[model samples]
Target: MRRASSLIAYAIACCLGWPAQAQDYPAHPIRIIVPTQAGGVSDILSRTFANKVQNATGATVVVENRTGANGVLAADYVAKSTPDGYTVYLGFQGTQSVLPHVEPKLPYDPTRDFAPVVLLATGPAVLVVHPSMPARSVKELVELAKAKPGAYSYASAGFGTTHHLAAEMFKLAAGVDLTGVTYRGAAPANQDVIAGHVPIEFDNLGLAVNNIRSGAVRPLAITAKDRSPLLPDVPTMAEAGYPSVIAQSWFAFFVPAKTPRPAIDWLNRQANEVFSDPAMRDQFLRQGLVLPLGSPEFLGQHVAEETQRWGEVIRKAKITLPN
Candidate 1:
């Protein structure tokens, strides 16, 4: 009986030592999983966060790209990971807000399966067309599309991505019929647009800014309430006469549900601090993104509101994806 008690105590102690306690959290290296290819916005931001966190706390931080199903694969992986703080997910509006409504049978619920950490940044998409295209302004593009319904196609990063939804919203609000050409990612979609394989795309401003400035693509209007400073000459959709076509992309951090409150709070504080720096803020603004620092509760509430907002867009646009 004494031996049995000793073995039991040993097992309990080993379990406790595995991750240490929430107070001594991050006893082990933490891994942040991103749902996009490396060199993309998501991957770049995730790596930046990891590097900053490691620098600030001297804790090992790893960023892994687990791409598939337009972020569902990585998100589901993080959802099923240990509830310990070791595994983190950098999820964007598509995975957290839009996918919930688009894919009813998603393996994990964004709200139910993960605990909110922080909302990192947000930005709008730039409405761009190939340089060869005659359209120079949003009005001209609408006129051209109206003249030839279904003759023009726009590149989408994926079926249910922000790129896709933004195009759909434009179609609905502008009363045009432009077919969508889906690509594996924004990089390839923008590449094809630049290559003239596709004439139109609503691309992330960060990704489209260089091409827009290089004259590889013509900037029509941005899908934002205010014109981006990076391309201040470009008008907003509202200013272009489509007040209902506002769409923006946002990114946030989350961990598997049931992670200790202390770990969540620690991560939230660290991320907010890293992004709130003036240098960091200016860096993101130069890239056409805005850093938003807020508590975990703010992220949670934002997710809920965005889900509902996108749900209406999905329903109205009648969007569906293939299995």
Candidate 2:
């Protein structure tokens, strides 16, 4: 009886030690690696998360930008970091899925090297046209582009980025040809769009929403089956008669692979809490995000499904890019 009692006590202690030990998680400052440039969506959103994390965990959270190679540089660094939960990467859909599809030689496999913490938010891609363009709706834009293939130039935040892939997918689905012009980031590219230097752009709602409200740019369609709350009147890609062209981009959280499960759980819970917070939700809205929260397992499956979906698009299109 004494031996059995000891064994039971040891089992209970082992289970209790997990999260109790995790209390030491951010013993020092935590570093969040943002895979894009300093001003992009991931950068802004991650910084907001980091600030709230600092308040919740009582540890300073720093955002480090490691740009280039379409976010592979940041992925490689974080994947190689210690699994002590001090380092994490903000994984964007394009950087994780579409870039690998287009470039074909990403340094680290997203599924292999990282563990998802939580799904932060999803930003549906929006098709916006310059005021100078005659198109007022998705069908009209398609008709015009079909009428003059390659005559209308559309700006992309980056080459083979989610926006670019979405545009390609739409073109494939709509059977239209519009030339793509790649830019360093959405802000500048969006600026050009608003200025009418580019005839059209496939942008995330964050960049295009306010401009759209101000009538600086014309919204053609949302890349989703249903209209977005931010743009309720704008028709969905499906409603525009191209249901298959719909695609919504998202951002996810990840720590280096092999981070303890308890730590991952804690982080995910903290993230869900943040997402549920009214202040944080409002903050995300101000930044043009519609915050959607989910568990680590949910985020993992989402990344897996998104990766597979992008793979299907690439395989069907047989997409290739130059170095």
Candidate 3:
């Protein structure tokens, strides 16, 4: 009898245009899971947004690092967590788009397991070479790699990452035979390039910006349609005669599928409010990220498009990772 009474009360509340949970949403602290290690661009960006959201909503937002399996672990954890608004995942290009193509047995489906929240930011990968290397431009690098024919090598975050795929695309377009050296993450891969251990690498602009400015590594070209404002003098891959070699990494937010509509709407509004701030815009821009805020539907469409695009690249390149 009591359970029936409670259901009747909830129905009455809904009929009156009031939902109790939505009205008092986010009543407790929220937790965000970052799938990568601390100090990388993704980690920094996730923490920055988390801080902004906490300040805006006056709710505790805790960021937890659950790094492993190229972000599969964290993504799976969030996908299986409660559908309440409290648990969120920072979804990136690898987990959302790339892995589905390269890894045949992903534990969670990108499209089916999560609800899109918002598209946060996007940035092109920068092709940088050690100062000790002879190449000064993208064309020169291609020529050098052709001349050596597998003598020169490039580094990547790991197999199936954007960094790896970007290098593969460059190889196919430029018709070069450069070997790829894999690392656990971008930081270590970039570190080898900066230390002159690796001759070349394709890294996110945000991670390579400081080193580029310091002359620790020389940037050949950015993998975007246009040159980034942060590196205005650098030409794009298209300008370097490889028009098909364009690639960029993007970040978004997601919650488990079947989450309440009102909770999702509230989270979207909060994200838009935080990203629309002038200060936040400038901060992201300085780090070589372009903030392109859009609706959840827009993010869903972007994810689908990117998955198809990268899947083709992976198939053509014959890219695969170990199980």
User: lDDT per prediction?
Assistant: 0.89, 0.82, 0.88
C-alpha RMSD of candidate 1: 4.5
Candidate 3 lDDT score relative to the true structure: 0.88
User: For model 3, what is the error of residue 246's alpha carbon versus the real structure, in angstroms, after optimal superposition?
Assistant: 2.3
**170-252, model 3: which lDDT tens digit per residue?**
98888899899999778799888888888999998988899999999999999988899999999999999999888888889
Q: In TM-score terms, which candidate is top? A: 3
| Model 2: residues with Cα > 4 Å off, grouped in runs | 1-20
Q: Write the per-residue lDDT of candidate 1 for residues 163-224, one digit (tens) a residue.
A: 89899999999999999999977879988999999999999898888898888999999988
Question: How large is the C-alpha RMSD of every model relative to the true structure?
Answer: 4.5, 4.0, 3.2
Give one digit per residue, the lDDT tens place, for model 2 in 1-323. Answer: 99999999999998888777786766778788998778777888778778888887677889999987767888889999999788989988866777767665677878888998988887788898888888898878889989888888888887766678788888889888878888977778888888889888889877688899999998988887667767889888888888887677788889999998877887788778878888877767665567778888888888888878888888777777755
In model 1, the Cα lDDT at residue 25 comes to: 85
